[model samples]
Target: MPATAIDIGTYAVKVISADPGKQPNIIRTVETLNPHGIAMPIDDLQIEQVGELVNNIVFDNKIPHADIRLSLPESIVSSKVISIPPLTDAELASAINWQAEQHIPIPKEDLSLQYKVLYRPEKSKQEQMRVLLIGTRKSLVDRFINMFIAMGIEPTLLETHVLSLLRSLDIGADEPPTMVLNIGATNMDVVVIFKGEIQFVFTHSGAGALLTKTLQQTLGLDLQQAEQYKRTYGLDPNQFEGRVRNALIPVINTLTNEIQKAQRYFASQFPQNTLSRIVITGGTSQLPGLVEYLSESLGTEILFSAPFASATGEIPQENQQTYSVCLGLLMRELA
Candidate 1:
């Protein structure tokens, strides 16, 4: 069977259809500007409108709607790793629900929780295991479900943006601890992965739209021209006589500050493991000079993620970075 994945990012709606088996073949990919509403919706009417846009994109692309997969951005969900005292499998099951109450902000009833035991501590005095807790608002889940129902289709899988973005990478388990920064339109999600385990997930409001808006205000340019200048001369010192770069520097600095905080937190948690690489993905990640800016700011190797890095054949690279979550969703079934 073939599966289709959709990620409704604020700036674009990204789609990927693949044939599912041992090796999923890339069938088609679609990217469309989210004309319904550029800003992500919080209310029902807006969600409904976006849902229609999603449906129309799929239908317009002539992609298969069955075996559908979806990804929700970091803004709407909570991901936390909690430590628990040693207990039996059955006991741990009971413990996580209680742990969710303590760690996740969503109420017990409104929360939909998922967990995985990452790894147990060494032969130490206070022996305990760490668990990854992923919780989403039930109403949010309901919103996605109802939105799909309006299209007469049900999604087979749903995941957070960070998880799906990580899945799209070719990161190796033997590799050193790495930081993945998803600079999406609405939110910036920083994830620390060590030995294939999630060490930390942090979501921040410092993101692409902020940079664009900063340029808009500082350069006294309209929204479209500001965005154009941003994409053209992003942090490129020589491009705009340092005027555009000057306006964007503060915003980029603030975002890098959050990344540095993640680095410190990762170092504190895993004293032995140092973050060696930083992977930048999402639409805005490709802004000119942005990668160089991050590399210089963080003093680490920075890599841009392409959607089909692991897949062979005629896979186009246009919009590759922004389609991370959607491609990873297809792989959730295909790979």
Candidate 2:
């Protein structure tokens, strides 16, 4: 069955549909954003505005009874890396639920959790397997369902942002272990993938908004001006200084610290595994000198995401970068 893709985040929701054919067909690709003005105060009016914007995109595009593959934002999802004895499908499912009950804080009834087995090297015993499990609050899940239903769509599949981003990279089933970082408005999520299996996932409290606030307070600029400055200066010592640089220091330090911790943990656990690359994604990833900074700090090869890494269709080159997750969702759903 073909898949429609919908990625709903705090800042925006993107929808794309692909049809089944010899060559991948793009049925529709549309996106709508929550106005930047409403980022600080998410109120009834802002919610209504977002609903209207979503409605307009669907109506204008004439997406009829679409079947969507949805992605949850990192802010609202819980995930972990766990090693379990390999088992049959039924046993794996049961084990995952039991594990979630033990590890996830929410009551079993209030959360929806699922897991996928990770790829392992051929030399390892088949029974020693790694898995990625994710849990989302039922309340949050229902809200997204309601919003999409109101727009005349029903999701056939639902997953987290990390999965979608990995799909965008087309990391092969046997590829080396790698890490991906998504820098969004509200938070930064670091995901570790070893030999195509997600080994760990963690989120940082501050992200793009933190930097924006730093600029606003230190430079006495408004949100828009601060955001512009961040994109312009972005860890570059020469371009920004004084309080501006000082304010950014905390967030940058925190970001690097998390990466170091993740790397160390992966190393200690999987002594033979090597982290060959790092991929950066999301809006804040456009920061002027972030790639260089992260590489220098982490001492690894850093790759900026080109969202359309493995899909077909001629999107304008400019939009191709950020829409990678949305496109990946479409490809996964329809392929």
Candidate 3:
């Protein structure tokens, strides 16, 4: 049976069903907005609402209660890269568990941990392997798992949004260093990838919602009007005599400043590897002139995420960006 991949975000819940293959057939896609707007996962009411949304989508689409893959929001997952001496699988597991105590701030008993070996030296004297460690509170994971269980959906895999984003891009092992800027409704995730491995992931509060709020406050317009203006004239100095652009400049600058800092830090760490290009994804990435603005400001080539290039589908263009995480979760299952 084909698996269902679900991406639960602050503003919306996206679900996609696809068969396993080189080019999975996107059987169905469903999205539903959260009526309560943005709420932290700690809120039981928000969780209940999300569960209802998922239940409605599954029922409306007549989707079977099959194995489901979920994307954990970046805001709740703590990720880090740790270096340790090469060891046997058994030894590595023990060592990682011990190391987790030091790296993860939460008590080890309260957090569920997972790690992936990212890089290992072929013929080096260092004798160490770089591993990516991810830790999340058990309560958080259990809440989602229990919710799905109650709905008769089996939760098989749960991964960070950054990792799922990486899989969606189909990046090659030999590809150069690239940065992925995922601008969503409530938050922005900045991910740095090199040689098909994630080097860094950062999340910020500056995103589409912030831009809309800025516009609403500055122009004294309603939420809907502000959103329309942002999408229609975003960052284009020539539009609305630059009023919209001027209003959004402060928020844009805050996001860009963080991006620039991340780039500098990455450059410092990897002096030999220059960022080859940047790929922008998520809902906010489609704002008018965003590509041009980021490309010029970061001084790097900019591209948009195109997961559908390999998959055969008839999804709408406007929904493509929002489905990236969902598609990526399916890709992970296929792999």
lDDT of each: 0.82, 0.72, 0.82
RMSD of candidate 1 to the truth, in angstroms, is 2.1
Tens digit per residue, CA lDDT, model 3, 259-297: 888899899989998987989999899889999988898
lDDT of 1 by residue, 226-250 (tens): 9899988888899979899999999
Using Cα atoms with residue i matched to residue i, what is each candidate's TM-score against the true structure?
A: 0.94, 0.86, 0.94
Q: Which ranges of candidate 1 are over 4 A from the true structure?
A: 21-23, 38-40, 121-126
Q: What lDDT, from 0 to 1, does candidate 2 have?
A: 0.72
Q: Would you give me the overall lDDT of model 1?
A: 0.82
Q: What is the model-wide C-alpha lDDT for candidate 3?
A: 0.82
C-alpha lDDT of residue 272 in model 3: 90
The 10-residue segment of model 3 with minimum total lDDT is: 34-43
Local error of candidate 1 at 106, Å?
0.6
Lowest-sum lDDT 10-residue window in model 1: 34-43
Candidates sorted by lDDT, descending order? 3, 1, 2
Model 2: worst 10 consecutive residues (lDDT sum)? 36-45
